[model samples]
Target: MEVRTPWQALTRPLAYPRSVWPWRSAGYLASSVVTGLPALVVLAVLVLFSVLLVGLPLLLLAGVALGGVERRRLRIAEVAPAADPHRVPDVPGLGAWLRVRAREQATWRELAYAVLHATVLWPLDLLAIAVCLGLPAALLSAPVRLALDRQETKVVKAYLVTSYPQAFAAALLGAVLLLALLYPLAALAGARAALTRALLAPRETELRDRIGEVTRSRARLVDAFEAERRRIERDLHDGAQQRLVALTMTLGLARLDAPPGSPLGDQLAKAHDEAGQVLTELRELIHGIHPQVLADFGLGAALADAADRSAVPVDTDLDLPRLPTAIESAAYFAGCEALANIGKHSGATKARLTARYDPGPARLTLLVQDDGRGGADPDRGSGLTGLADRIAVLDGTLTISSPSGGPTLIRVEIPCPPPSA
Candidate 1:
């Protein structure tokens, strides 16, 4: 079962008190007064002594301690565990941990929260509890006071209760008042918990850092995937390709040595032709996996080769410097996919590929345009979706402009630093 916080409890009218939320709220607020006073005094003394520089670490230590306390107290009102925004120290040592904590915004936020809790928020919490619980308790004691004193009793030191009936009526009114005040107390507690969360929760910078880490992880995965592809291509080219070449050569020699009309000679000829066809297909498959041309001569040459192989006549205007391996691979493959799409789907006779690198911006752009029926949709299994995803891993963009007429254009841009020789 999911536990609801005091704030969430307030939304459910009947369920708030039936659960432990009201008592938790009262306890949460009451404890703040207990914890905040000592923290306030320590913080003040440390701030006064901070000119000596010895107080800096002491103040940070006090704040760290208070942060732990506040997070625990928060669970009294908030069932959800509070997130700790502090990063672990990159180097593992006491000095390193202190240095990292001192630099973090969370440390400063915790300090500020400690100061506010001590100086301001706790007093409000005490006042709220007093009004909600104390006054009601005092009023509810009127019947007992009347019985013990055997005369008139005062309810809440104001209203006089002379008879048993009046004393019981005052007690009943106090009970109703107590019930009414519980809601406000819960609201106050919820607001205090929310304030604590706002101050101590992860900031925008931390979220951005998390996003950057995820992107780096994704880039690593892409690098590993590309490495595996290259390894497979290398194995095929060096091992199986060599064996097939030797086999084809031997069969050719045997066919030439045998007499022309013999059945053995004809069989040798057929076997040789079949072996040659299989070798050609295997080489094409290897190139499609991870082309040797892309690895050897870089993206420009690889793109030119891909364009030459396209069934549609493709004109090329490519100028590039050596780029990071990942960037080169992504750009080359994206270009190849675009050309293949143009050949297979676009009923155009001509296509053009233009590529350029801008060193100032550290960006490479490739544009493939075809004079074909131009209604390319990646959702229709056009093969561009995978290419787009591959390019996106490099923080690159792939765009297509293909209206339902003629002339489709695909553009890809990737950010990459020039490779050092």
Candidate 2:
């Protein structure tokens, strides 16, 4: 029985079953002999060292240690180890190096596998080698005849029956029986190797862990949005709203008590006008935080308003397949931020905003592009960050590109309606 290549310990477990492979037993038996021969030679040498007084105790300890290492390697280093194969990638800094100290948990087991290999592999190999070679030799040797009684010599001369046809039949029978034994034996070896591979091999756990981290990160983003919303509500009610009310009262009292031509009265009126301008700006800032216009007139109206408010001329290409409240809000905010960035950084004189929907998968795309001075940096605290966060909470994506010179583009893609919402 022979095999083409020496399979890695990890791969052996996944090999084709013997029932499906006529040659599997032969190959497996061949492989065992191929691997086990060296293992036995080493084992014999180690045992010899153990017989010497000075080296005896040390050899015994080393043999035991080698056995442990092999078993541990089988369990943890294999391609499909049942447990986590990731040992170093997850940990950072010198902590990864420290993981080696956990050897007692991992190394000992591998050594056991090595020791077991030493004891069992050679026997299996020898059995396969003996049957495979001896049976064929015996069957072929039957054809040769000697003198009177016809003695054949393989060892001490033995009287032999020399009819070529009969000898062929007997040899053929021996070969058949040996082949039959191989069928089940190879299956048994492959199955055993598979078990070892599963227990000792490594698996890719990092990718799954990274996905989990992204999911948690998205959840936190949603929590952050709600927190900011609470903050904005507090600012509007307690600071800006209260100040505007006081300014209005003061201006009204001045107008009622003073003559129109008086310098003092005129000055108070001027002060009132300035206060109104300040209030207007505050109101616009609050609106930027969350547009109430979208709730009243739908996404189209809110988006039109955003385009109208842009410092640069904005061309609108918005046509909706009609969107739900959450999607509408996401699209509105995304457009508003993109336009804001264009006005603030992009030097392009002309810009366009477009929106569209596809119902098959139920999705929407919003594009804001400008041919201005270009070079917009999303990292430098642009309104784009908030827009991205808003879309992400809805399980959407935000992409931006602004090369130096004259063009900047921002695209937001959101699932038509988020599952949770």
Candidate 3:
């Protein structure tokens, strides 16, 4: 199996030595001096002159820059890429960028990491490389040192080697030591990579904030949709519906003036009847688009109006105050659909609709129950599936309990803002 992390590679004692991970780890640790040294110099200078007030901002800027670089550098030992936790500025320019970075927790964490790295981590990295790699290299070059000097030579600045055998022996020992130390060196590199990722990657709280922003955006879209529906409803009610009513009245007046039993009188009556039917259909269409009662009174009266029109006899026990428009719309549509289904397919004589609102948690619950030959399944192309999805967008739930024999119940519960007083 392929290994992605140093710790995972360490688990296999044999194949790890043969893999390319050792070189990768060595490279990661060796490169620490590149960024760490510059960071140390910059941080020291900024602190010394920070009384000027300019140094503080520059220091933050430096930290932010270093954070970007370090996140990229983590790719050496970490297979998974680190995501930048700072949000992009709304407007472009250094001023907006700085303002956004200053407000992010990632920026502060990066600054702290930079400080710790400059003071402590770089020295440790340097020391580990020197002892683990440099020492072995020096020992392996013992025979060459002796030959070049034509005399005695100090092995690793400690053991003295005078003869060829001693020089050769030191070289052999160096090779063995180099092989043994690679494991710990790779392990150390893995630890360093993990620390860098922790400071630079997105945090749990930042992820939560991002999810919240997305939900609010969806809610805004739902509100805009409802507003557009209301606009269309208003236009039809005040424009086309009113014109049709006037036409119907004019046709009625013309029919009354015509001679009784004449062809003209029969034609006028037929035209008047057609116009009246058209007006009634338009009124129903306007109401379906968005009920004016819902906008004027609220969900309670709107559901009552719907119950009065349902083909299946419905008894309602609802005591609710005004709610958010989106919530009210969703609940109203769900109730209307339930009653329509009952009238068309339930084969029941009566249905009951119940609604209640709890102020403690500010939740609204509506129930529609019908005593019918019941086997309602949303998966079977039922309209309840659409109702469930719409409710889900508002962080509400739709549940149906329908046995095969009788009595289908649909319950909707939504957390909403407190009703307007």
Q: By TM-score, how accurate is candidate 3?
A: 0.56
How far off is residue 263 in model 1, in Å?
Answer: 0.6
Could you tell me every candidate's TM-score relative to the true structure?
0.56, 0.44, 0.56
Q: lDDT by residue for model 2 over 1-421, one digit each (tens)? A: 3342223321344453333343543554455555556666666676777577655434434444554343343332223324432244333565554455244333444444545667885586567556664555565555553232354433113434555456566566656765555445554545555545443332333455566679778766655764676478568967987889798779979877989889988888888888888778877777866666775677888999899988989999887745676577668877877877777667668799998876656688888888887778767888778778778877899998877885788888887542231
Q: What TM-score number comes out for model 1?
A: 0.56
Candidates by lDDT, descending order = 3, 1, 2
lDDT of 2: 0.62
lDDT of 3 by residue, 252-370 (tens): 99999999999999999999999999999999899888998999999999999999999988999999999999999999999999999899888989999999999987899999999
- Report how far residue 185 has shifted in candidate 2, in Å: 28
Whole-model Cα lDDT of every candidate shown, in order: 0.88, 0.62, 0.91
Cα displacement (Å) at residue 240, model 2: 4.5
Error of 2 at 366 (Å): 1.1
Q: lDDT (0-100) at residue 389 of candidate 2?
A: 74
Error of 2 at 385 (Å): 5.7
Off by over 4 Å in 2: 1-217, 220-224, 227-231, 234-243, 260-267, 321-330, 373-395, 401-405, 416-421
